[model samples]
Target chain A: MAIPLIQFINVSKNFGESHVLKGLNLSIYKGEITAVIGKSGTGKSVLLKHIIGLVQQDSGQILIEGQPLSQLSPKKIKLFYQKLSYMFQDNALFDFMNIYDNIALPLVENSRFPKDQVNKKVLKRMDQLGLIDIEKKFPSQLSGGMRKRVALARALVMDPEIVLFDEPTTGLDPIRKKKVHSMIQEYQKKFEFTAVIVSHDIPEIFNVVQRIALLDDGIIKFEGTKKDILDSQSKILNDFIAGKDI
Target chain B: MLNKLIEKFGEKTINLLKSFGRIILFCFSGVTNIFTLPFQFAKIIEHMWFIGTKSIFVIILTGLFTGMVLGLQGYYSLVKVGSEAALGAAVSLTLISELGPVFTAIMVTARAGSSMAAEIGVMRISEQIDALKTMHINPVRFLFSPRIIAAAISFPLLTALFDVVGIFGGFISGSMMLGINKHVYMDTVIQSVKIHDINVGFYKAFAFALVTTTICCYRGYYTHLYSGFGARGVSLSTTNAVVHSCIAIFIFDYIITFFWV
Candidate 1:
């Protein structure tokens, strides 16, 4: 078997009295979409944050490409970060910056790209994402779906090795949610980047993701392909999938 | 009961010390980043516009009125002592030595400092700062350093402007409104303001700049840890930043004046 692109070894986290994650172990492969599904406030987002170094685990190890994250040298860590992109639940676009500048920030800050080259890259991404005319418009000026597109464009602008999505279809209507999932699928194929999506979209998400992980009570209770999960005889996983209050 | 009181006091003291330690570290990070290479000139210039250029009108208005008041009062007191010719010396000296830097700092605290706190607080609550961090942009360098650089450069300059406008206001009130000869007033003003006095004013302005900007930025940067969340948290952070910065400015003013004197 190939080495997992990312692996969590008995990770744990606590916020004050609440234990958000407890000895949670998981692995993610390169060039595939893995969905982590759990009910609200079950630390699904915290788990995603841990993967991106936004939130630190209390114990255990997170290894990226067979190397433990905490052990990397500063320069190597910078390289690690360069390979990662996170799409926040809020989009987190700089409200003061217009769409073009927003999309160009990572490039402009990370590299000394000439203005024209930066412009070309941003415009190309904008064009591909159907965000051409709205380049000058601020994130606040755009509609929900359009803002989502801008976020995706900015995330993909760096051509990172891994992308983590935190509820990308949140607060959208059904049709828009489907569109967003489809957008994610299309982009993942086009870019061939490894993806870890934290979501609760259930059956709709099952179709989009290759594998599923069910998290409850601070541990991943199930991990397998969608077909495997559907055929498995796990009561807790079944109850969660059926939307029953466990 | 007494032990419980002592314990509670100890806890509070430790918490206060920790808070102070954090503030010092945060300010140190911002100050050190100001010297980091590949300087953030664009953001620094933008902050200078926000902190300095936008503050010109309010500084001028405050300086003029303060000087006018000093002239009116100084003229009356000097006439009683048969030294009304010394009115120019009195107003200019008071302004250059004390009021110019202090009032400019307070006015700036009310204007730009509050805005900095509120803006950063909003960004913190909204996770925009985290977004920057994830983008590999240091939030302290991107947000606070530019503001600190702007404040360090702008405060002394604004204090100088305040002193000049105030001296002019005194001239309007004394030489033009009253019967003091213009040349005598101008001469007394020129003779009274030693370079040391101007230095004292500027030193105070520089100190106030660091104190106010650090406190405001520190308060806003740590808004997530405060007692509230969301809008109320932001409001609390802004309020604490402005109130604490103003208080800190006065405290540092006294310390600097004590040492300089």
Candidate 2:
């Protein structure tokens, strides 16, 4: 009954001859973790990009907090970006900047926060992620898990209302993946912000997300509770569940 | 085969026009971006380190050797004309007016421009540019403007350095090697080269700097618009930046000459 925080209304996108997204309609509520599961190259990342205005839809509308994103000018779109944050799959921290500066960059660039305040916020986030000791380390110096954690900390530095994760659990060992999954759960619980995760790692994401959306052939085939996804009888869903088709 | 060839050529021509149009847009946006953030002195200083200080050694080496070669060649030509004392004027004029800025930009294109394309292209593919946008940071103001401002400021100074060193090279060749009277050689240069020539050279250098930096940054910034091998995309952009910079420098040089003459 509540107004959804983000909504995609008949959204579609095409890259040349290939249609990546086709009339995809979905809505995400505030303070909920919604996991989008799909095979590789199923336009999961492309869908996430549209939420943040990185990629534009060819048709339909993307609404953030009920305001149409497609109708906004570039300047207004940029203003809307302050409320949303995206953590890239590869944890694309600027290699040239140290971890502290990487996390402090948004604050220094956008907000009126003084240097000392920025440093203090960065240090606090570093401490929260148990990365206080690695403040001076560059992205090249950190391990894969450490880099993702640092990136997540940076994403949360501005305390955005929504966070989108692109394959957050990829390239991690089982234990590290579990840790990352729990970290997502922990952040969601603490902040009560909207979280949309795009991943193929179903089991890990299933534990955190309340609803699962399965995408195939440029369409959302199913959208329901995690139990509905587990007990799905749809051939496409079964094929995805058995890992028989991508 | 004929149809395929025509199609390919047509595509290339369209692409060329598109590139030209994009560059005009980039220049307009760059001007607006500078006005929007007129107090970005710290960023300008930071990019001075990247675009100026980082390329200093290459610029100096290219300038010195170019001067040395010009001195050697000009001396031989002047001797044939029985005007060996005019070596200084010839070397200084050529180096300052053409070789100094153009060669410096080309060398930088090979070094810094290629690296910049690679760095920014990788960032584009990786979605780092998107991250900047999500944080409400304008990539043009944060990334591109500093490099443009830095190169514009440094190119003229480097051209001056090149001119002085080149004339010194000519001085050594004429007086020491060819045994021309040192006083006469110096007097010939001082009399033949007017201050207007120096002013024109600096103006041309400034224009060259703007062209080179704008092209390189534009290529790197929009590299993702092209497909296929990412490395190949970067390689093509680097080549385009260098070729376009050279052609633009010469074309602008002719226009300036037309007016100055």
Candidate 3:
């Protein structure tokens, strides 16, 4: 098999008495859009976090581009982190910064991109993301959808090899949701970057995501194409697919 | 019962040591990157403006009132011994040696330090810090070092301002109000106020700045890890940051004074 772009090797995580991930093993191939679907409070976000080393596994390891995340030293970890970008559920844009500066932060801070270049890059990203007339506006000034787009612009400005989206369509209206999903699909098609999205918007994302991983009881119960999940014999998986909490 | 008590004591002791070790490690990390490459000159300027320049009004007001009170109180006490001439010496010494640095630090801990904690705590909860990490930026170096360095630079200057304003206030209260020989009071203050006294105050101010900023930043940075998340967590961190900064400032002030004096 082709080497996995992202790998969770029997990972386990516990938040006090709550075990979020238990010996969970999953892999994402390069240039593929993988959707991680599970009930709320499952470790889907936690798994995304582990990919970026924002959180650690209590047992086992996560690997990005074949390098184990846990084994990397702090210096190496930072270097490794530049390869992946996480688009948070809340957008997590700095409210203090305008759209331009917010998008340019990673570039400016990490790459120390020059002022003129930073301006050009930020403007280009904003234009591509259809964020016009909002460059100077702060995150608080924008609508939720606009803020999400600005955050996507920020994440895309860095242009990492992998982008993890946490609930990409959680709070958007249908039009905005389709807009976001289409943007993700178009971006993934163009950039060919590995995309792992943790989302609750069911069959809606079915058309956008190529593969689906069903997380149940802290373990991935099913990993297959959307068609395979649709045809699965597992009643719990079916229950979840039918939008029922098991 | 005895075994359980021992177990509880051991657990608490271990937790304390763990927290102490983490603080030390965080401080070391901060110190390592403080003067390193990619120094945040703009951020430091912004923080200095926030922590120092903007705080002038309050510092001036506090200094004026504190000095006036000291002068008024010192005159009555010194007059009982018929040593009213020593009132200037008392006010200047009290300010230059202790009150200037301590009170200025306490004020900063309340204003800038608490706000810094709250800001970072909110960032932690909102995952802005995590966003920074994903971008390969050291959140501590980016979010914290500037504030710490600014506090270190601003504290001494503010203390100096406090000292000067306070002396003027004392002048207003003493020579202007108490009917003392104005020239004598001025002369005593000018002659008796040695550089050692001012030096000690500046040194203590620097120490207090480090204590306040470090503790406050630590509280904010680890609030999510130690406490929890959301508004309640941020509020707790802000409160704890101010209280802890005050406690640390007082303890360090005593320790530094004992050793230096």
Error of 3 at A177 (Å): 1.1
Q: Which stretches of candidate 1 lie over 4 Å from their true place?
A: none
After TM-score superposition, the amount by which residue B51's alpha carbon in candidate 3 deviates from its true location, in angstroms, is 0.5
lDDT of 1 at B7: 100
lDDT by candidate, in order shown: 0.89, 0.80, 0.89
Best by DockQ: 3
The residue-by-residue lDDT of candidate 1 on B20-134, one tens digit each, is 9999999999999989867889988999999999999999999999999999999989999899999889999999988999999999988999889888888888778888877
Of 1 and 3, which scores higher on DockQ? 3
Clashes of each: 0, 0, 0
Candidate 3, superposed: residue stretches over 4 Å from native: A64-79
DockQ for the candidates, in order: 0.69, 0.78, 0.87
The weakest ten consecutive residues by lDDT in model 2 chain A span: A237-246
| lDDT (10s digit) by residue, model 2, range B120-146 | 776776668878987878887777777
- Of models 2 and 3, which has the larger lDDT? 3
For residues A1-246, could you state the per-residue lDDT of candidate 1 as single tens digits? 679989999999999999999999999999989999988899998998887778999999999889998998989888888788888888888888999999999888877678888889999988877787888899999888788788888888888789999888887789878878997898789888899999989889998888889889999999998889879999988888898986
lDDT of 3 by residue, A75-107 (tens): 877666677888999989998788888999988
